[model samples]
Target: MAEKPRLYYFNGRGRMESIRWLLAAAGVEFEEVFLETREQYLKLLEDGFLLFEQVPLVEIDGMKLTQTRAILSYLAAKYKLYGKDLKETALIDMYTDGTMDLIFLIAMLYFKPPEQREKETELVVEKAKSRYFSVFEKILKNHGQDFLVGNKFSWADIQLLEVILMVEELSATALSKFPLLQAFKARISNIPTIKKFLQPGSQRKPQPDDHYVATVKKVLLM
Candidate 1:
């Protein structure tokens, strides 16, 4: 049997969460090595595991992969979740890239001072609804398909689904105006692999809280 891919990162979501979601959507099992202290992170850098001196690394198929996009692309294409054609792949890329914008925006909230967080969250939520979610809502409405690209499940769908839930965590009514997206969420969540990951006791991590933020700050020396 092939060994499961092993992930290296702080215990929190960060960029690795998408990788975990994609792997789960692909029905692949994996392992994680969480960095609990600054020493562990520095040790990996000293060992040359982090090519860019940053994390979200993975060991898969005998290669140590760095960069979140590179790792996700490799897993997506390998698992046949990338799409059926170059055009479809391009569409997937466009959608995935857009989601990354929102992902990073929300991620920065964890580092914000408590006073700034509420206001920043409002901005993030507004940007998500106006800039990001609206675009996806239009796509789903026009395409009238179950999946994001080519009417088939792809990495883009997985990414959008993940981001949709992330935004919902911030605003419960995030999808209220986007009926198609609400349906899209329900549909995607029903997929067997994704459904399993959504259940408790799976590899999926929870939203970052005070402890997670502090631990990550210490680990990365931020």
Candidate 2:
């Protein structure tokens, strides 16, 4: 058995992707147990041999940890990828949660029926985009760095990228109003580690059950 960090996360590659990016970026080896089917989840649960609790559980040999976001934060901290200044860490958290909100709103809007989506977007879309983009716009305005916090690449950068991709996957014109945000994503996206992680060969490709993936597929068909 290899002594690599083991991560039990969604096979569809949801929130767990950024964690994979961090590990891949660090050249850290680990087991990836993917769960994208109910049968798979049930079978894993039925097999009592599986340790720890949740799907996104990460086992560091004898030590097992859980939670998707927290796992990435721990890895970022352990690898000195969290950025230099304490203030940078603070901003990272702020931007990360902000980006998460946008992704969440997209899901909520999508789950709603046509009439409901109309009723909801009046308050959701603008607020979601503004709240998320405001923090990012501020970061780009203050830091010429390729990433969200300070001058180094961090988890927040990946989180923001996911949000932009998710939005674009929902609305192609998602970032048209904010060229800086678009440019920022384009810049951060080409980082060697992130670029490799997002390559065609990587299993990070979106899946069916994925909300954004399904939406994009629907758009393409129309």
Candidate 3:
């Protein structure tokens, strides 16, 4: 039997959720190592365990992997979550890259001061919906498929689902206008393994409340 992979990240989902979803979908048993404190993260860095000096590190087959997309790509290929062929993989890569671009915009909002967050978030949300969301919806429509690549679920779909969930959590609104994207998220969530991972008692941590949006509010009161 192959040795199970072990994932390292903070308690929150952050960049690790897509990889987690992939693992669950693959039905592979893996261990999650949560570094809940600065000390733990620093110690790992000191030990040179993280090649990229980041979390969401995966140890498998005596090899360590880092980077969110890189890890997801490797796992997707390993477990056949990567699409059916080279052409499909290229499309998957394109969609995944686009999703990451949106994710970066949201992350930037978190780092802004409280006074600027609302205005910034609103602008970013509008741009994301108009640009990124529209593109994804069009892709689904063009392909006449529920998934971004081919007709089956792939890592691209998982990444898209994670991006949607993150945006909804940050904005507290659904993508009502983009019905196809909304439906895509719903379909991915309903996958048996993904559903199981989402159920109560799952090890996944609740999204952090002290995130940049909330922190800025607190800072302003002081």
Best by lDDT: 1
TM-score-based ranking, best first? 1, 3, 2
- Residue-level error in angstroms, candidate 2, position 221: 31
**Per-residue lDDT of model 2, residues 1-222, tens digit only:** 658887765554555666776787665766777554556655756764345435566777476666667777788888777867789888777777677666667655654567787767656656756776765776687867666676677877777887677667656776878878988888877878777777887646463254554543343232
Give the better candidate number (2 or 3) by TM-score.
3
- What is the full ranking by lDDT, best candidate first? 1, 3, 2
- Candidate 2 residue runs with Cα over 4 Å from true position: 36-53, 107-125, 207-222
**Candidate 3 per-residue lDDT over residues 41-132, each given as its tens digit:** 77878888888776678998788898988888899998988878789889888888888888777766655677998898888878878888
Q: In terms of TM-score, how similar is model 2 to the real structure?
A: 0.75
Model 1 poorest ten-residue lDDT run: 213-222
Q: Per-residue lDDT for 72-167 in model 1, tens only?
A: 999999999987888998999999999998999998898899999999999999999999989999998897889889989999999999999999
- Output the better candidate (1/2) by TM-score: 1
User: How does each model score on TM-score?
Assistant: 0.98, 0.75, 0.85
Stretches of model 3 off by over 4 angstroms after superposition: 211-222
- The TM-score, computed over Cα atoms with residue i paired to residue i, of candidate 1 is 0.98
lDDT of each: 0.93, 0.67, 0.77
